[model samples]
Target: MAEKKFESDAKRNERLYVLYYIFGAMFIILLGALAYRQIFMYGYYHKKGMLQTQRRIIQPGARGDIYDRNGRLIVGNRPVFDAVVYFNDARFDFRKEYARLNKLRKQNKEPFDYSKLAIAARTNVLQSYIDEINSILKTDFVLDADFNRHFSGRQLMPLPLVKNLSISQHAILAEKLRVDNSAVQIYTDTYRYYPYADRAAHAVGYIRPEIEQVDPDIPGDDLRTFSFLGKIGKSGVEKAFEDRLAGETGAEIWVVDHNGFTFEKIESKPPRKGGSMQVSLDMELQGAIEDAFPNRKGAAVALDVKTGEILAMVSRPSYDPNTFFPTMTHAIYNDIRDRGAWLNRATQGLYPPGSTFKIITALAGIKSGVIGPDTVSYCDGYYQVGSRKFPCHNRYGHGEVNLQQAIEKSCNVFFYEHGQKMGIDSIAKTAKEMGLDSPTGIELHEESTRLTIVPTPEFKRKQGSGWSKGDTANVSIGQGDLRQTPLQMACFAASLARGETRTKPSILHDTTRKTDMKYHGAKKLDIPKSGYDAVIEGMVNAVERGTCRRAAIDGVKIAAKSGTAQVMVKGRKLTLAWMIAFAPVENPEIAAAVIVEGEEPGDASGGATAGPIMREMFAEYFKGRQVAQ
Candidate 1:
């Protein structure tokens, strides 16, 4: 009995020994794994953890401000909130759920395409979320197709579902998102704001939404995947100085929790603000000049003759640049574009100079020795050129007239004879020297300075055509291909006032400039002072008692010339009325050019149409000067 009991004890001891060996082996394996993790594998795990919890965020800075010459704010930026969706994060959560189902389906031994099922499930989830958002915001959020496309093409970018959100809308979205911790985000952003609405709409310009990459070779850790870079300038001064106006981008380091909620800010660098712009624009005078125009399809410009400083420039039928922001409605865009409202007519509209070209022709004839100051020409209602009668503006001409009287009366016969005598080449040379064939060098991006038609023998030769007596007669009267922008005419009038060519026309204020304003190239006309006085006398006489009598002011002496040009518009004949003038002629302060387009055939001459506008502009200038004194 004792031997059997001892044997039973030994059997129990053997079982205990077997259990101890197994536990000892397990402990050694666990200790080795701990040592390996703390040593060789530590860097890999630490990197993985950091990638999950730490993130880099980019912050976009605000655009700069724009101010007029009088220090009034013309353009600025305003804070806005945008509702966006980070599709990558949403896809991550969707795939996690899909993997759980995938495991269950695999356990059940079901044959199914995992990729196809995952896509269907993700689409349904996203649609349901959009439906919820729509209910809260009371909007029809139909972004299914756009979401699919963005997910395929730009998955890292945050898709902006709604921009420029109202305060109430933002509040509701924040509250709803807080409870569910959804992948949707509300980001703080900025959009351009024009306080004066349509005032200075063309000169100030507008902005549009765009993504700008600073450097494509930058490391991924330097920027956030879904950061919102603001809109960029699309036209006007905005486009002219885009680099100086668009601010620099910044970055932030954030520590996030396991659920992707940012818990702490590790480090941050604020964005740098852009530089402001100062332009030579007087809002008050601009409004006045625009209001003085007779038609809504023409242009007007007033210049400080001595300095070539543009005091006022007005292009009719202008559109509000603010309408371009946050996406313009198709109807409004089409309407404005169709009406030619986007055209800057002050420096871009091309029209015949009419009798104003007589100024250049008279100078050419005198300079070329084809005519003297006392050269007399007969105007018996018409002039004979190759059997065709070129009728004068005055059907019953001034019988016989000299240079001064012809200019005052705008007799076509006097200019016709001189133009044929000197030919188109002489006239074109004088015109080019007087700053007529080049741009005025204004700061606007839309200024157009296409070569004006001179119709010289060389010009005709290049066109596979030849000069004829009729062509010479037409060129003399500013008809046919002769075209000039109002800005050019203003410069011409200014040059006449200063007795030299002044080509610099700037939109930047002298006071705001950091350096001296560069000299715009000029040419000295060597004509005798008596010649200038003779032409000035005729222009003054025109305003005093001739056709431009409407432009004469009570206390100011204004030298003036009026022109009526014929043009074809939409298969219909139209007349463009023009007036170029300088006030207080002896010591001119302002030189102006005004044009009213698409006037009726019998609509009073340029004197009656554009003359009053010039008179009003000059009156305002003198009134301001008087008040200032």
Candidate 2:
């Protein structure tokens, strides 16, 4: 019996030992798991927690202001007021409404989608706020169609309830509403403003709303972000200087609660305004030139003779850029498009240079040794090129006329005779050398080289036709396939005034800018002094007592040329009246070009239409100079 009791005691001791080993192994496993979670998995959980609690908001800076050369505001920002609702401020109301709706649904025994119920509740709550706002402000306010989408995706940002409030309306709302702690607050934003309305509209350009991603400088990129819409350039100089004009982006990092509602602002950075710019446009001159357009469809450009600065650029049938801000409707856009107002005519309109191109023809004749100051040609109403006779503007000719007399009288027969003698290649060479074959390198994206044409023998061959003497004669008179923009013609005039082969136009204002820079591989016009003298004398005489007489200002000695070219538009023949000129034969100041599209074939002529406009431009320019002096 004693031996059996001792064996039982030993078995009991063995069981106790097994129990101790199991408890020790379990304690070790628990300690190991604690260390792993506390050290190795800490960063992962911390990041996940951060993502749920933090949110980022991005705001765009105000775009830079654009000014004229005389410090006049061309394009600037105007403060716009908006009534907006912050979703976070209405979170409690949202929850309360959701609970009430869910209870009602349960009592009715109707199946429900949680998302749909939530959306309906939010909409109802928001409608109540809108109703209150409407009652207080006496304005009709409605919820946007994208309310549900905004609630789902961009709850952190304020939703605009009413936008672009007038001064009185904004004042009334600010005085009536409790803005400090209310869900609905007055938000001040900026929209582009045109102080002069449609003046310099094309040069100033327009902007459209664009939503961009958060910049790299902003923090918490991995967190859910809300961005405000920013403006981007749509055309003109705005598009050309987009990078320089765009403002720096600002950011705010907020600590959000479990429901994605901002509770605390951790960091904030105010946006910086974009860089300001002063363009070369002179608004006073621009206005005068725009008002001088004879019709609704035409273009005019004026440049500083020495600097090639674009003083005035006018494309008629222009729009009020202010109408595009805040928002643009389909109707307004369609109207603008239908009226053909969207095109920048100064740089984009391609037309035959007309008789204005005679300047180049005369220069080419002189340069090619075919004609000189003493060269004389007789005109008997028409000139025969092969079997075809091209009629001059005067059915009765000026008899025998010298080079200067031919220009003064605008005798087409003289250019026709001399042009054929110089050949088409010489005229084309002179035209291209004058920068007529390419864009002027202005700070506008609308200017294109492809649209400009300086036709040649090879060019005609490519079009499946051979060059003809008739074509050359037509080209000599600035007809045929020779196409150029008003801007190009203005640049040519400016370059000629400076005695240079090319003029590189600029829209920026820089007093230190040089005009001696080579443009388009063009060199100085190396024609004889006598050649220039004859052309200038003829141009001056034309403005004083000849076809361009209307362009002459009282005390200003102007060198001018007038042109009337025929074109077939939509199977109807129309005339384009043209005038190109430079002022003060002694010291050139401004050079200009004007083109007017005629309603009928014979209704428009260079002197009758474009010459008067040129006179007005010169009048305005000298008037301003006198005031300054």
Candidate 3:
């Protein structure tokens, strides 16, 4: 009995010893694994933790206001609400998800268009949140094709799910998203507004969203957020003065939770607004000019003859720039662009000066010793250059005429004889001297330069042709590729008024105390004073009793010239009527140029079509000055 009990006790002791050894071995192995992980994988885990907790974002600043000369707010910002979603916060892996969707499409035997497949993958990933938003906001929204492009191109920026949200929709989204909204957010954005619509749109310019365009002027380190809301000027004064008008970007560091939700702000920097730009445009006068030529296709330019400052410039068939905001539709953009509504005719539209170029021709003839104030040319109604006979405006002939009488009557035969004698190079040299052949150095984009026909020997060679006497004859009458913008013609009229050439045409007032801010006064021309006096007398006589008699305003002495340019359109001859004038001729203060595209050849006469427009505009401009005096 003793031996049996001892055997049972020994067996039980052995079993307990085995269980202890097994447990001891397992504990040692666990400890070894724990130490290995702590030492070797420290960096990987630390980096992963940091990524989930900290975020740096950029805060975009507001752009500056734009004002007209009268302190009128031509352009400003209006607050709008936009719904945005962050790709990083959503943890969306575009490549992996795209692969998965591609596999499914292959299994389903569907066509493999990579673009469509990509869009499908994006739609699948964003569907859940979109559904939730639709339910909460009581709307039916679809992520369209633009979503694919925007996501692929600018995934670094927040994806705008909905733009310019309504008040009710915004309130509903905010209420529903308060607790579980880490990936989605509603933010305030700005929309540029032009208070006066299309008035002076060409001069004021337009703004567009900063999608993928990186400005060389902006520092890379400044913008930390991919979804920063920024805008840039596309043309006109906005683009020319971009440096002074674009705001600085700022940054903020935030501490976030594991779900990538911002819990608290770690550090922040406020953004700085851009500087305001003050221009020399007058909205009131702009409106008047636009209203005066409703439904007419042409351009007009008015300037301060004393300072060379452009006051009111108008191009007909202008469009409202507001239509380009948020997102422009294909149809709207096509309609505006295809119809040439975006063109700034005052500075970009080129046309022959017609009789207008005679002013320059007369000046050139006088300076080149080809003709003088007393150098008489007989016009038996026609002048022969080769076998072709160029007839004067008066087919019956002025019989014999001098430079002053020739300009007043716009006699083509008189210019033909002198222009042939002076030659193309001489005339071109003098035209360039008066700011005709080159750009006016305006601060606008798309300024058409070198389009005017200087018609020199070099120019003829460049055109793969030779200079001819017939070419010289056509050029003398302001025909055969003699093109000039209305703005340039306005400058010419101003120069004629001042008896000198001035290259300064500014939209900014000279308030800056810097040396560069000084007004560019007129440069005295090298022509004889007799020639200047003779031209001025002819211009005044033109407005008072000659061809431009319609431009004569009551109680105001006006010096003026009229032009009727001919062109062939659709195999038929057409005309463009033009008039240039300055008021109070003795001490001229304002100069203007107007061009009207006549529907018919005979329908367009400089004195009949364009002269009345200048007359009315001049009247409206000086409406109160005479009364007040």
Candidate 4:
């Protein structure tokens, strides 16, 4: 009996030892796992926790203001009022409503998706707030269609309930709502405002909303982020100076709860306004020129003859830029598009330069020694080229005219005779040297060089055709395959007045900019003083007692040329009336170009249509200045 008892005690002791050893090994393994997690995996788990609890928000800075040369505000920002709800402030209400709904579902023995139920509860709570706002402001506010997507993607940001509230409504909401502590708040944002309305709409341009996602200075690159809508330039000077006009981006580091609701902002940097810009446009001059247009489908441009700076640019059928802000509807967009108001006619509209191109022909003729100041040509109603007959404006014609008389009377026969003598190569060379074949390099994105052409034999040959004397006759009178913009003509007038071959136009204002600097490798006119004098004399005679009589102004000696060209549009023949001029002939100050499109045949003429408009522009420009007798 004693031996059996000893054996049982020994087995029991061995079983106890085995159990302790197993427990010891298990404890050691557990300690090793804890050490690995605490030491080696610290960074991974900490980053994951931070990503869940923290978020960064990006805010765009206000766009800069735009000013004219005279310091008048052309484009600026106006305060817009919005009614918004912060998701964080409504968290408790969301949880309570969700609990109530869940309980009701259970009691009714109905199956429901927890996520869907939560979303419904949130929507109901937001709707109740919107309803309260509607009662206070007498508005018809409702939840947006993308409310669920916004809630899921940007839970930490404020959702706008009613945007672009009127002044009266904004005041009512501000007075009745607890903006500081309530779930609903009044948020202030900016909308682009055009003080002058459509006066300089094309030059000032417009913007559209965009969101920025990346900011280098902000932390937490791997974390989720929320953003505010920012404006980006779409056209005109706004697009040209986008970098200078766009403001700096700001950031906020926020602490969020498990439900992704922001509870505290630990760090923040407010956005700064963009740099302001002062353009070379003169609003008063711009307005005056626009009002001077006699027709609705035309363009006019004025420039400072000394510096190539644009004084005024007018494109008719203009739109009120104010309509584009605070949200543009498809109706307004369609209306603008239908009216053809979106085209900047001054820079984008291509047309045959008409008689205004006579200036180029005269220069080419003189430079090639094909004609001189004393040259004379006989005009008896028409000139024959090959088998075609080109008639003059005056059927009977100016009997026998000198170079000066030919220009003063706009005798087409004289140019046809001289242009043929000079040949197409000399004419094309002069035109290209004058920059008629390229864009003016203005500070606008719409300027294109594709349609602007100074057609030559080479150009015609590439089109699988041969050049002819009829083509030369057509080009000599500025009618065939020769197209230019109003801005280009205006620049040409300025360059001619300054005795230069090219003018680089600019929309920015700089008083210190050199006026005599070479532009795009521009050189002097390369014509003798006698040649320039002859052309100037002819132009002066035209304005004083010739075709451009209507362009004459009291106490102002103007050098001007008028033209009438033909075009076929939609299978209908139309006329384009044009005028190009520079004022105070001896000391040129302003250069201008104007064009008027005819609605019917013979309805428009250079002197009858475009001359008066040019007169008005010059009258306004010399409004308060002393004029040379």
User: What C-alpha lDDT do the candidate models reach, one value each?
Assistant: 0.78, 0.88, 0.79, 0.88
Pairwise lDDT winner, candidates 1 and 2: 2
lDDT of 2 by residue, 1-629 (tens): 99999999999999999889999999999999988988999998888888999998999999899999999989889999998889998888899999999999999998988988998899998998788779888878887878878877898899888888889988988877865345678899999888988777887788898895578988887888999999899988788888888889999999988877889999999898899898999999999888877655899999998788999999877999899868889988999999899988899899998999999999999999998999999999999988999999999988998889998999999999999999999999999888888768887898856778998999999999999999999999999998989999998888788777887888999887755645334477879999989999999999989999989888788999999999998888999999999987788999999999888768888988999899999999998454211
Residue runs of model 2 more than 4 Å from their true location after superposition: 1-37, 106-113, 179-182, 517-522, 624-629
Least well predicted 10-residue stretch by lDDT in candidate 4: 513-522
Scored against the true structure, residue 625 in model 3 reaches a CA lDDT of 77
- Model 3: runs farther than 4 Å from truth? 1-54, 83-162, 166-186, 212-224, 255-264, 511-522, 627-629
lDDT by residue for model 4 over 1-629, one digit each (tens)? 99999999999999999889999999999999999899899999999988989898999999999999999999999999998988888888899999999999999999989988988898898898889888987778888868788888987778898888899998988888865355788899998888999887777788888886466876767878889988889988889898899888898989888878787898888888999999989988888878878656889889898888888888888888788767789999999999898998888899999998988999999999988899999999999988889999999988999888888889999999999999989998999999898878887897856589899999999989999998899999999999899998998898888888988888989988876746444789888889889999999999999999999988899999999999998887889999999989989999989998888878889988999999988998899888876
Q: How does candidate 3 score on lDDT?
A: 0.79
Q: In model 3, which range of ten residues has the least summed lDDT?
A: 513-522
Error of 3 at 237 (Å): 0.8
Provide the clashing-pair count of each candidate structure: 0, 0, 4, 0
Better of 1 and 3 by TM-score: 1
The TM-score of predicted model 1 comes to 0.79
Pairwise lDDT winner, candidates 1 and 3: 3
Error of 3 at 152 (Å): 9.7
Superposed by TM-score, candidate 3 places the C-alpha of residue 188 at a distance from the truth, in angstroms, of 2.0
Task: Provide the lDDT at 426 for model 2.
Answer: 96
Q: How well is each residue in 1-629 modelled by candidate 1, as lDDT tens digits? A: 99999999999999999889999999999999999998879998887777777766656667899888789888898777877877656766687768877887899998899677677666766776677778889998665466666655455457777677889999999899888788778977777889877656766778877764443432346333445556678777787788888877766666766645556777776777789978777777777777777645888888877667777778877888667667788987998889888887888888888998888888888788877777899999899998899999889888999888888988889999989999888888888888788878887777777655555777777989877888888888888778888989998998888777655777766753332123657766657666778788889888988878888777788899999888887777888888899977868878889998864566646898888888888777787453211
Would you estimate the TM-scores of all the predictions?
0.79, 0.94, 0.78, 0.94
